[model samples]
Target: MACILRGLIRLSGLDKCINLVELNLAGNQISKIEGLEATLQLRRLILTSNKISAIEGISHLSRLEGLWLQDNRLASLESLALPQLAQLPALRSLYLQNLDRLAPNAVCRTPGYKAAVLAALPNLTNLDGERSPAALNYAELAAEYDAFRANPVPPKQWVVPDVAPWLAGVSQEVPMGGGPGEVALQQRHAKLLPLRFGAAPCVSGQVVKVIDECEMLVRVLGEEIAKFGRQAEARKSSAVAS
Candidate 1:
């Protein structure tokens, strides 16, 4: 699911989607990276151009393939960054920078950042959109990871004590704005705007407003009708399965 530039303030409403394979939430005001524990099968996780300052509660995404976290506020490496990602054995692509876009976490500026990351996650084929050297023996690097995993050490707290929500998969913060409801309300008012003039088109407003209002209403209602229709249609198609 791609939800880019939606003005999302918080990362909410992905708790129960255990089968979610990919999620892209770029260009938003999200401050924290929480929720999404149930999506163990998730592959591509894109969260660039966000305000994410910390990375926690995102452990054990073993099936993740691509992770994009560039252009964020992540700082520090040892404290919470690497440990949260240590379990993603299937992750092959990790992006933290975009050439001319110049998007990178604060930690990327630190010396040996690339080397240290490659050393830790041996399976990565691409880092910051650059391919790892073919000459590098990934098999040799695998042993080091195996050793580290076999005798894991507890990670220290990042100032505050590390605490996950009572429910791991629940959304920590809901995005600001009433979303569709607010849109619908605005549209309803706009739809009846011309009515305010009592049967006269002399209200003198943008035609875009009327179109927006009607479209928003149609979209909102159409989705509801489609949702129920799908459920009803499914039963007709397969009675035994239903």
Candidate 2:
């Protein structure tokens, strides 16, 4: 352990010796995995917490089989190439955690990093304490669904028939059938009609006028209805002719 820490003290360790295996240099101030390639027989390398910004040195450890590098500042694993580990034919497990620290605020900004990490460690069937990737936090996702179910929608009021009948009359007349300008106006009135007809079934109103004045609304509303009636007659006549 001391030798490993010494090696990481200034990004240099175990260069003089050989025949070493199972080294752990976790929780140090080291910002990268430098040196230690001297340990040709090394199998397990655990560098859980440090300042590892990159994972390029992994390619040098041909004998390395198991690795754990969680809680680091690694922004990306795209530059890393660990083909030598796979050459060992002994590599089985690789742990990668704390990736949330890579760019906790902007994960979507870096998509290639996730792909590179998976590609570099192909034989790694067991990852991040899981015997398989299926051992992830499914319960947390279920909890989110439960929270969404508990949320309530806003309340709405019911519409009266007296108000809707008047509105529908307007929709069928000048605004809807009289000309193109009235088409938009008719659709707007149709939408409001549902509320007037108690479709909301929550609240009720005594008097429902299209707007402030009932007399002007009634007159224009009738004209719209008459126009739509004429279009309907024309359509019926065409159908009969056909």
Candidate 3:
């Protein structure tokens, strides 16, 4: 562990260390991972608590097994590729959490971060020096479920019903035939049903399971209706304010 207050600003002057197997450069001011291409026999690399943002270089380390890169400035793992951890076959152990040295990287704070990492690097036997089989398994399952259904929705104009009649209760029946925008409103909601259910897609199997899915569907439908009512109320308020 190097001094946290003062550390190397750059990684250099290791051209001669060709046979270096393990390199520990924790708690440094180094902003980049560079100047280690000649270390062909490199195995273990520790680089915790540095200013490094994007993960680059070190694609030549074919024999690498352990990698420590906690407390860095890495943003998102989605943007990294070409020579990513997946390309490294021998890598088994990885450390990417900060304790007392400095703050953890931004990727660590992302939702399903561990799942993303494990999904990208399936061979990783250890993560952050430990393993929780239950959590990892759930993450993997969640990642798989969202992979295909996760579609980017485009901004489209939607015609929502004036909900006042919808909320007028059973005493007053809503018109059997809506006046003008009813067809467009129905069509719009038809298209949006899939988008709303994408998060909690239906599961098929036993009778009880299908019943549970139906229950969830009813609950989501109720919530969506309530949300539309609220949106209509908000629009009315905004119009009055103007």
- The prediction achieving the highest lDDT against the true structure is 1
Candidate 3 C-alpha error for residue 201, in Å: 76
Residue-level lDDT for 208 in candidate 3: 28
Question: lDDT (0-100) at residue 78 of candidate 3?
Answer: 59
TM-scores across all candidates? 0.51, 0.45, 0.50
Candidate 3 TM-score to native: 0.50
Q: How do the candidates rank by TM-score, highest first?
A: 1, 3, 2
Q: Deviation in angstroms for 46 in model 2?
A: 1.3
Encode model 2's per-residue lDDT on 171-208: one tens digit a residue. 43332223555445545555455565554632211122
Candidate 2 runs further than 4 Å off? 1-8, 82-88, 98-116, 134-242
Q: Candidate 3: lDDT of 126?
A: 79
Q: Which wins on TM-score, candidate 1 or candidate 2?
A: 1
lDDT of 1 by residue, 1-242 (tens): 43333778888778787888888888888888777777777888888898887766567788889888899887767633775576777878887776332787888777777777877777788877666733454434667888999999889877878897544442223222346644554454454444444456533234334545766798899999999999998888899776
* Candidate 3 off by > 4 Å: 1-6, 79-83, 98-103, 132-242
Q: Give the Å error, residue 2, model 3.
A: 15
Give one digit per residue, the lDDT tens place, for model 3 in 1-242. Answer: 11122368998877888888888888888998899888878888888888888777877789889888888888877533423778888988877774331456778777887767777887778777555432455445656767746864666989986655432322222122344444444444443333333466332122223444676798999999999999999999999999
